[model samples]
Target: METAEFPAATSATDGWEPTLAAALLGAERAPPAPPGPLADLVAEADPGAALLARLAAEGALHRAGTGLGPEALAPTEPRDAFGPECPPAAATRLYGLLSEGYSARGRVEEWFALAAASGVRPPAWLFQALMLHRDSLPATAPAVVGAELDWLARACGEAPAREAAADGAEAADWAEGSVAERRAAFAAFRARDPEGARAALEPVFRKEKADIREALVHALATGLSPADEPFLEACLDDRAGGVRLAAQHLLPNLAGSRYAARMAARARAALTIESKRRLLGGTTHSLVVTLPEESPELARDGVEVNTWERRGGGARASLLRSILGRAPLEAFAEHPPRLWIELALRSEWADPVFHGLFSAAKRTLDPAWSEAMADITAEAYEGKVTGVRRTNEVLGMWAEALDLLPDAAWEARVGALIRARKIEVVLAVLAQGPEHFSEPFTATLLDWLAFVTRGSDALRRDLAKPWVIARLGDRLFPSEDAAAAAAAILARLPEEDTDRLRTQLTGLTGVLDLRAAIRRDFRSETTTGGMAQG
Candidate 1:
């Protein structure tokens, strides 16, 4: 065939294919002839090296001749835009703050709030970084970030258009959107009008995929009402286990709902309290459990009978615990909570009964019962109570109950526990304690820390010291006396132990200093009405 009649390679890169093939197969086996302009370029060059040199020269020429093709038309500006661009100084400060290894990530919300309050939007290039880290931002962030993201989505299509559907036209879009979009739509609908959201989902309930149906059912938890119960009850028999479990979890929160009442009835039937009076002393109570031979009704209510053998008791005990856990706390009104607790503590079914009561206390959030449970837990932790196991599980349950107690009550208990050197109880209290402590409670805690660090080698080595130090940093370092507290802690550090702890103590001091500086800068900026120069 004539050379022109043969197919012309598209570019220098494609033209090198034959030479590369010959080199791989060995030139002696399959020598390649340079084609087209490459033949003239390599005519005087060494044959073995000529092909590669020609390919390189031709590639360079092609690249040099190429120019950026005509630019595509720019995207239209979004009709909706974010507020004013973020202040350049403030943006710089934000970049610096985020780049550092700061332990207090919660402070990012404060920054976002300040930005929003100032009516400033972050730079466009920073939007992707912000989006990736958005979970740390407060829920209110979207009010500020949403418009900016919408602008970004329109310009570059990087983000999903999650703005609430406008008017009625977008409802069709919502139904046809991806799972995340549908969830967002359902949430927005629930917020605006819960009954309407439920109505919208009902028609599509059976038609939705199993996972989607489960998610939609869970959405009922927001703004739940008697109106949602009928639909939820029907969902108890959903083909998906997750959907059924979601229904089971949501029903108990409706204290007076029929589902709760049914659970209460089952619990009462399983166990009865009988009071007995001693001849010379006070009245005592005993529990008489009458487990059902079979309880399909309870099973339908979400009680799972244990198929596996248990050390304490078999399926009967599991059923009792499940029934008691789901039963309304009000169902035990015949006897005071304290009376029931006393009976539960002394009864043969202590573990299951306490488990159920703890569950009930958590669900109801009854202050009195929560306090009583906390005391019971403290007594158990201190080894003052009989038949109460002191495992981590029991301690955890106690801590959970204490979380429901009033802040004042919990703080007081923590102080007393710390003073008594009940390290385990103190740790438990601190683990579940509120983020911010009252001034007096903080002082008491600092005093405990000072005492612990200075007391004994053994005390310093106790695991509680490190736990206290790590957990109390946020609470302590923000106080006005942070520097003084840090000094006190440093002074108490044993001279012999100081070497091992210097790094940790230095970090703590550095954090305190940084927080102090941040506070001062924030105040200065607020007063001056000007951004702090980075």
Candidate 2:
């Protein structure tokens, strides 16, 4: 009966200290012996057997106090009274010995009767044995198993008793059990009747001293869930901070709820409309204001804004929306882009705001609104502005404006023209520039042309002879001297596009010789590089 068949299962491993203290805990003095006949009967039932029962009992109580409870024994064989191989006659004899010690003077039978009817007494391991060995016991064994669980609910509150049960149960719950099996078992046990479990744990919650409550609560936590939110929430009023904190930690993930909504409402209540308009635009017609006052960290003194303001909002608003708090970007939408931009630069946007901005920007296309978005995107990329996806919107805007410039306007803004057309589009645009390029614009174009021609033979072919001549011809051939200079370059230039660049000094020669034509053609026009041709 005392066989240690499974050493690994029964032996304590390093760091897995048992709840010895709770087990050993008892009233300062021992309880009086069971009334008269029960004590005598226990004394007679093999003194060695009685001692073993007491030892097992003590071990069970210790473990139960630590929040681990024991499993009920099989009814076919009372583990303490008879080993597994005990014959049928021996089982009857063992049952007689157990019944005598438990029910002497009718007290045990009286307790059992009350427990069966009203379900208020403690569980008996002997009853568990009978239930476990149900096939071997009287057909009434189901009633016994049910009664044991009900009794356990009452017993769970008593530290020493609970500790004992916990100890006995720990071996079974953890011994080679799969997580699913353990979860299912605990779920089933707790579900049978939680009111009983609740009552049992209530006493443990209040009375038993030490950190035993930690284990008890953990045991109870396994049974707790969304259904238990009301109970856990009520504990928010607990006198014990640890208990309250535990309840609070479990509240968020269990209940599909959060503190964000409450915080957001509070933030919006404090927010003023003037604040929103100042942050965003005043109306659909007005451009976004980018107001300084809209900044969450705007200084009362109207002091000079620092780089912090220039980069993101200042610290005050940031901390409000950080990990510890909730800062919803939708909360700031009343403001226009400019205001939020100004505010964001001051607050530094922080990480959370960056995510919110990402959400908002993807959904809208307001320019000033989106420009502020650029800052957040840049920040998200860790200050690098290289990748296409990150730059897509901004680059797309620059691209659209280029395709619509008029000839006169394109001629006036050379830099703007460079931006509009691909290098291939430049010659076409130049031809439409009033048959003449401005001396300044022409000079800039010449620099660009020189750069391209020298860059590669592939580019030279791309800038075909006919195309280059058409672009520069009108300006160069206005007079005989200019025409001859252009012709001399043409003669030296490669006749075909496929010639080796080094073999055909054509493109380079054409660019160098154009200088004289430039000077000759513009001689009469106030002495600048070139003039408009009629």
Tell me, by TM-score, which candidate is best: 1
Alpha carbon lDDT of residue 258, candidate 1? 89
Off by over 4 Å in 2: 1-200, 215-224, 254-379, 382-534
Cα lDDT for residue 260, candidate 1? 86
Instruction: State every prediction's TM-score relative to the real structure.
Output: 0.71, 0.24
lDDT (0 to 1) per candidate: 0.68, 0.40
Residue 463 displacement (Å), model 2: 42
Over the stretch 1-534, how does candidate 1's per-residue lDDT look in tens digits?
222222344432344445555556653454545355545556544655765665565555545554221122234674455566665555655666666524446555556666666666667767766666655656666777777666666576554445533543246444657777667667767877899889888887898888788777777777888888889899988888888888998999887788988888887887789888999999867778776544566666788765463454577778788888889988888887776775677678887888887788888888778878877776775666776666877677677767877788878877777789876666666778776777788778777767767777676666334445554555553554765686678766767874435455555566655554444433324456764532
Q: How would you encode candidate 2's per-residue C-alpha lDDT over 373-490 as one tens digit per residue?
A: 5433334233243222334333332222222234345455545545453455454334443544455554555445555555566667765543543436434223344444434544
RMSD list, candidates in order: 10.9, 34.1
Candidate 1 regions with alpha-carbon error over 4 angstroms: 1-93, 100-104, 113-136, 140-174, 292-294, 306-313, 382-397, 464-468, 475-477, 498-512, 525-534
